[model samples]
Target: MTLAAKKKAFVELGKFLGQFASSGSAQKPDVLCNDPFFAGLENLIHTAQHHNGWYTPEQVFFAVQSWANALTPENLDQWLSRYDFAEKSPKTVALILAGNIPLVGFHDFLSVVISGHKALVKLSSNDQQLLPFLAKYLVAVAPKLNDFIEFTDGKLGHFDAVIATGSNNTARYFEYYFRDKPGIIRKNRNSVAVLTGKETREDLVRLGEDIFRYFGLGCRNVSKLFVPKGYDFKDFFEAMFAYGDIIHYEKYANNYDYNKAVFLMSRFNILDNGFLTIKEDTAYGSPISSVFYEYYDDLSDVTKRIETDRDQIQCIVSGVIDYSVPFGKTQQPELWDYADDVDTIKFLQEI
Candidate 1:
């Protein structure tokens, strides 16, 4: 299929997804293959939690909406405009997806097929349902796409290139296993925010979305906060209170109870606002229901530190920091917002 054909298929898929949200789902008759896919997708959204406890309907809907916003013709064209897709031979690219969040690895799947290569996807067990369903939808829109997408349950083989996402340990295994082939091995990376004690209440509340969304499972979620020395917690805690209802989720509440107990037992000086906990720590990756914070003496020094440790960080959320993703926008990454600062499309084109 031509690039335009492939792009058009995804654009249709996006329109289908746009009909569903956490608030409710409505079938759009104009959406391609809606008669067959609309009800199935709505069911999937409602029951995703049964397959994976973290895949709440709200979270799944958010993921669906995010992809709906991204797969527009304008956005697709703008992103692909930077690349030359001509004169390239097709290869089978193996994708080892991560299930930390809903549809976490769809971008890689989209990248492989849209670049005129076949995708051999090994869906994360935690995320087994959504992509295959969408793959079916894509094939329905463009029958040729059937030849370009495959899902594997057993050991992956017969792939010319690879993209794998996992924790730091598994990344090493991938590096060694795929050493001979062209590959992109992604490791664990966390996002953080720098607060200068001048943030508006609205900024801080939006920052709560960066922290609590997906129950803080995504790499894009801000797990740490860098604040000026002796920064008051009064306003910060108040801003976080806006998301207090997050505690109603049993899994999150369990983490809060367990982590709070552990902290109390360890005599750690932690602050809690009923649902979330904030502790002063030097680490960037914090546990669920908890956010680590540190005091900074100088913004310049903090910037240099973040620059030096860029590999360990996925995103920095701040209005003041240069290149930082604005507050509340970490999860709504555009097509060009390559994960771990590695461009998947470029990697595929090169391979």
Candidate 2:
């Protein structure tokens, strides 16, 4: 399919997805292929948790709405405008996706297709259904697109390059196997927030959204915090109260109970508010029901630490810093905010 055709198909997908926002889901008449895909997507959203328990309706809808907002004509045009696609030879780019969060590897897939390359996708078993169904919608919109996309249960048959995301352990295997191919191998990374005592109640509340979204499963979720030496937890705990209802969820509650018990058994110091715990530790990745925090003597010191451990960090959430991700905006990445600071489109163009 032509780039224009692929772009147009994705725009239609954006419109179809736009109908299923978390605010309210309402079908629109202008969306293409809705007669077949609309109800199918809705039913999938309702049953997504059966496929993956982490894919709750609210989180799944949030993921859907994020893609809905992203796959727009304006966004696509603006993002693609920077690259020269003329006379580019197409290659098959294999994608090994991670299922930690919904649609985590979509940007790579979109990058490969829009750059005039074919995709051989190996979906994580935890997130096997959604992307394939969406691929079906795209193929229905533009029949030729069927030639550009493939999903396989067995080994990848043929591919020029690869883009794989996995834990630090699995990443080693990917690096060893795909060493001969031009590929982007992604490893586990976590996001952290830096805080000052000066934050307002509203800022702190929005920061809670950054911490709790996706049950702290996504790479973009802030799992750790850096606070000033004398920072107090009273106000922070009060703000996090907004997410108290999270404890009612069985899986999260189980994690909370289990992790909390483990902490107590270790006799570690922690502050709990029924739903969440904030412990003063120097770790970047934290457990689901708890967030680790460390005391920073100065903002400069924290910046230095982040720069030192840059590979372990995905996003640096902060309200005080101009360069950091805003209070609650870590999960809502723009099309151009490439993960791992790697330009995916540029990678595809070169490959």
Candidate 3:
């Protein structure tokens, strides 16, 4: 398909997705192929938690809505404007996805398709249905797309290049296995927030979203916090109360109980507010149901330290950090906000 055709197909998919936001879902009369897909997607969104406990209806809807907001014509146009799409013979690119969050690897899939390459996708077992279902929708929107997408449950084969997202350990194996091929292999990355005591109550409230969304499983979720020395948690804890109901979710409650017990057994000092715990630690990746915090004596030193360990961090959330995304916005990444800051389009085009 031509670039224009591909963009049109995606914009249609976006419009179809736009109908299903976190608040609720409704079918749009103008969306193509809704008879076949609309209800199926709704069922998937509702029952996602049955397949993976973390994929609650609320979380699944948020993921769907996030993509809906991203795949618009204006966003696609601006994101693609920077690229040179001079047509070249299509190559088969293998996609090894991460299922930690719903549609976690869809961007890579979209990148391969829009860059005019065939995709050999190996779906993450944890998230098997959503992306393939959308791929079907894409094919329905533009039948020519049928020729460009394929899914595999077994070993990937005969692909010229690859893009893989996985934990740090899996990333090493990917690096060794795909060493001969041009590829983008990603490892574990965690996001953090830097806080000043001067932050407004509203800022802390939104920061709660960064901490608790996706149950803090997504890389974009803020797993750690940087606070000034002697900072009090009284106000921060109060703001986090907005998400207290998150504890009602069985899986998250189980984690909170288990991790809290483990922490107490180790005699580590932790601040708990019934549902979430905050501990003093100098680490980026924290377990679910908890967030790690470190005391920073100077904002400049913290910024310098973050820069030094840039690859380990996926995003920095703060009003103060010059490069940071504002609180609560980390998970809502634009198409140009590539994972690990790796430009998948450039990589695909060059390959």
- In order of TM-score, best first, we have 1, 3, 2
Return the lDDT, model 2, position 298.
84
Cα misplacement distance, residue 166 of candidate 2 (Å) = 0.2
**lDDT tens per residue, model 2, 149-262:** 999999889899999999999999999999999999999889999999999999899999999999999999999999999899999999999999899889999999999999
- Worst 10-residue lDDT window for candidate 1 reads 21-30
State the weakest 10-residue window (summed lDDT) of model 3: 19-28
lDDT of 3 by residue, 1-351 (tens): 799999999999999998997677788899888998988999999998889989998999999888989999999999999999997999999999999999999999999999999999999999999999999999998999999999999988799999999999999999999999999999999999999899999999999999998999999999999999999999999999999999999999999999999999999999999999888988899899999999989999999999999999999999989878988898899899988999999999999
TM-score per candidate: 0.99, 0.98, 0.99
Candidate 3: residue 216 lDDT (0-100): 94
Candidate 1 lDDT by residue in tens digits, 49-137: 99999999999999999999999999999999999999677999999999999999999999999999999999999999999999999
Whichever of 1 and 2 has more lDDT, that candidate is: 1
Model 3 regions more than 4 Å off:
none
CA lDDT, candidate 1, residue 97: 98
**Model 1 Cα shift for residue 132 (angstroms):** 0.3
